[model samples]
Target: MSSCHKCWHCITKRTRKDATRIVDVKQTKELSSPGAVEVDSPIGLLASTTAAFLGRARRGPLNTPVFIENFSEFRDHFGGCWSGSMLADAVQQFFSHGGTNLYVVRIANNARGARIDLPGPNGPLVLEAAEPSSTEHVRAAVDYDGIEDEKGQYFNLTLQRLAPDSSIVLDQEIYRRLSCQSDNVLFVGSELARSQLAHVCNTVPAHRPDSTGAGYINQTEMGTDGSALSDYDLIGSPELGTGMFSLNKIEEFDLLYIAPSMTSCVPGPAAVLAAEIYCRRRGTMLILDPPETWMSTSDALEGFEEAGYAHPDVLSYFPRAMSSHSATREESIAIGGAIAGLLCKLDRQSGPWEDLDQQGFELSHDLLPALDIPASEAHRLVKGGLNVIVGQRPGHAMVCGSVTLAHGSQSGDQFTSLTTRRLCLSIKNAVDSVTRRTVFKLNTAAVKEHIVADVRKYMDELVNAGALKNDRFSVDCDTNQGEKRINCTRDITISLTFDPACSDETIKLNICQAKSDSEVASQYA
Candidate 1:
C-alpha cells in the first residue's frame, strides 16, 4: 500500500515527469473467475488509471453540481509570493466574459504563504487565506463571507448600494469584522456615488458667520482677518457712532394703493420693495402701502424701517370692494398679460438704444425727432419714457415724459419716417389730482373706452388691408379719482408702435398725435 503525502514537495515529486519512469508490479495468487482475470488487465494500465483519479481528487469534493469548466494554471516567473492583483485580474476577466459569479482556488506551498491576487474590471483586489487540509477548502472558501484564522482575526466582505453620503451601510456582521481595520476596506459601486463622495470630502465651509442685524454680513465688510465689523475703533470716535446709525430714508407720495389679489400682488410688492430699497440707498422719499393691505406689506415695511427708512403711511387698497365686483379672473389675467406685453415692447425699444448710433442716428438728434422731441430734451424724455414704460409694461404705470426733437433741423428729417412708426398719445393731468380719487371716479373708464374704440377701428382697417393678421389691440383702465374730476384732468397717457407705411389708412392716421403747448410733439413724415 502507498501512503498519501500532503506535503507540497512530496506531491510535486510524485506528479513530476521523472516519476513516470517508475515501475509498478502487481501479482495475483489465483483468479476468482476465468473472465475476471482478463478484465483486470496489466499492472501498467492499472497504475496509470489510479494516478489520474488521485490527481483530480486532490482538488476537492464535487458535492455541488456547478463546476469550473475551463481551468488554466500559470507559473509565477518572479518567484515572489502571489498577490491580490493577479486574482483580481482573473475575476474581472471571468465576469467580463459573461460568468455571473465564480469562486477561486489557490494552491501554494506553506513556506511561500498562500495568497491570491485578482485584477477585476473595476480594479485590482487580493484574497488571502490559509492552505486547506482537505477538499472541504473549496466549499469553505465559497461560503466564507469573511476570514476566520487562528489569531482570532476576521474579515467580512459585502456588496451594497452606495449612499448619498458616499458611505455604504454594511451588514452588522460585516461591519463588525471590518471595524478593526476600516482603513483597509474599499467600496466599489457606480460613478455617481463615487462623485458624490468626492464632493462631500472636498466641500469647504463659509468663513464668515451670519449676522443678526441682517441675514448675512456684506462681503465687502469682511477684512483680512476674516471678520466683519472689525475695522471700527470702540473709543469715542464719531465714525464709530455714525456706523451704528440707520442707512435709509423714507419719502412720502400722494397715495398708497395695495393690489387685492395675490396675482396682482406678485410684481407689485417686489417693485415696491425694490423702489423702497432704491429710495433707502439714495435717501429718496416713498409712500408705502398699508401693512394689512397686502400679506407681505408688513414685512416689507418692517424691513425698510429696520434699514433706517422712515415708516410710510398706507392711504388705500386697490380693487375696492365695489370695483372688485366688476373685475374677473380673466380681466386680471388680461391685465397681467398686457403688462407683460408692454414690458416686452419696452425692452425691445430700449435695447436698440445702443445700436442707434451705429444706424447713423444720435439718440439726442436723429432718434428723438422720430419720437417727436427736441434734440436737447430727447435724451431726458427717452430715459423717463424707459422708466415709465418698464413700470407700465406690468400694470404699474407712472406718468412719464416722451422723447422730442428740434423742429427745424434737417437732422430730424432722418427720424421723421421712423417716428411715424409709432402711435403717439399723451395725457397731462396733475399727478396728485389723479391719484386722489377712486377707480370708478377716475374718468379712466371713458378714456379706456375711447382708446379701445380707436384701437379696434385701426386694427379692423389693418385686418381688412391684410397688413395685420389679427385684431389684437385691447385696453383697460383704473384710477384713484372720481369720473367727472378724472375726465377733467389729463393724467392718463398711452402710445403704440405702428407701421406708418401700412396699407391701412385708419391705422396710419392714428400713428401721430396733434402737438400741444405742454405736449412733446413726435415728428413722423
Candidate 2:
C-alpha cells in the first residue's frame, strides 16, 4: 500500500555530519564485488537478516518487544517460533527485563503449561500447575478458604497457593470456562483464582502428612474434635466476619457449603450504602450470602430517593421513575439490593450509562401519564424546573431553575397559523411532561405581537399600586437556524413584602399566544 524510508537511512544521514566516513553505495556489488571488495565477512547482511527476522517475529506474536527481551535465549530455546512455551518464555523474559505486569494467552493443548514459584531470593524454587476454570472460581480460591475435593465437595478453611508452572493451565481453564458465560467477569482475576483453587483442590491427591485416610469428606468431623476450622479448610471473608456486608462475593458459586461453626458478620448501614452506590454505578449484581440486616425500609427508600433526585443530571434522564415500596425493614433492604442489581443489569442490556441517559430522555415522553403529571411539566421538571428541598431553614433556602423554552412563528396563512399552534402545544406538552404540572395559557394574537408592551403595562400597574419600586426585566428575540425558528428570551425580577407570620410567597406566571380561527388542538396521544 504505502512505503516509507527505513530508520537506518535516517540515522545514518543524521550521524554523517559528525562522523568522518560517509558513503552512498547504489548496489551491494559496489562494496562486495571483486574489484571494490571492502570486507569479506558479509556481517552486515547477517545483521540485516537477523534484524528483519526479529521485526517480523515481533509482530507475529503478542507484538510486544518486551516479551522477547531475551531474544537470543528465546531463539536458542524455542528458535523464534510461535509456540506456547515460546510465549511463556517471552512473558518470563519480559518480566525479567523489568516488565512487572503481563497477560498470557494459553491455548488448550496437551503441552500447555505454566511455571510458578513462591517469591524468594534463591535460584532454585518449587513449581507446580495452577488449575482454575473461571474468574469467580479464581476469586474463590484466592479469597475464600477451601478447595473442591475429588468428591465434588468443598473443603473449608484450607490454605493453598498455586505453583508457577500451573499458572498457564489455570488461566487457560478459566478462560475456557468463562468464555462460555455472558457475564462480565474479569479474566485476569478468574485465571489467578482458578490456579489457586486447583492447587488446593489437588492437595488431597498430592497427599500431606496430616491427612487422615478419610479425606476431605471427613474433615468436618475433625473440626468437631477441637481442630481449628481455618487450619483444615478454607472460608471466605463472610464466614470470618470480613465479607462484603451488602453483597457476598462468593454468591457466584452454584452450591456453597459453610461449616456449622461459621458465623457471618454482616456489614453495617454504611457498608450497605457503599455497596448500593457501587452496584448502581457498575451495572452489575453483587450477591450477598448469609444475608445481614443493614438499612431499614424507610431509611433505604429515603436514601435512594434522596440520592436519585439530588443528582438531577442522572434523575432527569432516567428512563423509569424510581420509587421504593417496602412493608418491612428486611423487605426494604431486599428491595434496595434488588434495585441495585436490576439497574446494573438494565444498564448492561442497553449500553453505556451515558448512552442510556440520552436514550432514556428520548423515551420519557411516554411516561408522563403513569406519573400523573402533565407531559410539559414533566419535561420542564427534568430540564430543571423543580428543586428538591435539601435544607430549607425558616427564611433561607436553595432553589434551582428549570430549562427555559422560547419560540416564534410567522402567520403565513390559515394553514401556517394552525401549524404554529400545533408546534406551540407540542412545546407545552414536552415541558409539562417533565414538571408533572401545567402552568401556561395561550395568549391572543394582539397580545403576542406586543409581549414587551404588555410587560411594561403590568410593571406600570405594579408601580402605581406601590408593589414595585423599580422594574427590572429584559426581553429579546432572535431569528436563527436559517430564519426558520425565532427564539424569545426573557428575564424578570420581582420583590415583595409580606406579613411577619406568613410563610414564603410564591408567584406563578402564565404566558401564551393567541390562535387564529383555523387553529385547532391536535390529539397528543
TM-score of each: 0.15, 0.18
Lowest summed-lDDT stretch of 10 residues in model 2? Answer: 45-54
**Model 1 — TM-score against the truth?**
0.15
Superposing every Cα of model 2 onto the true structure, what RMSD results? 29.4
Q: Write the per-residue lDDT of candidate 2 for residues 346-373, one digit (tens) a residue.
A: 2234311112122221111111111223
Candidate 1 lDDT, 1-525, residue by residue in tens: 122222111111111011122221111133243323112111110010000000011221111111121223211101111221122233222222223212222211111112222222233233222212121110001112334545433322222211113333211111223212223332211111222111111111221111122121111111111111111210112232221111111111111111112222222344445543333322222222223222232343343344332222111111111112333322221021121122223323432111122221111110011011233443332322111111212222221222212122332322222222222111111111122122112244654554445445544554454444345543333322323222232333333334333223323221122212333221122
Cα deviation of 288, candidate 1, in Å: 13
The local lDDT score (0 to 100) that residue 229 gets in candidate 2 is 24
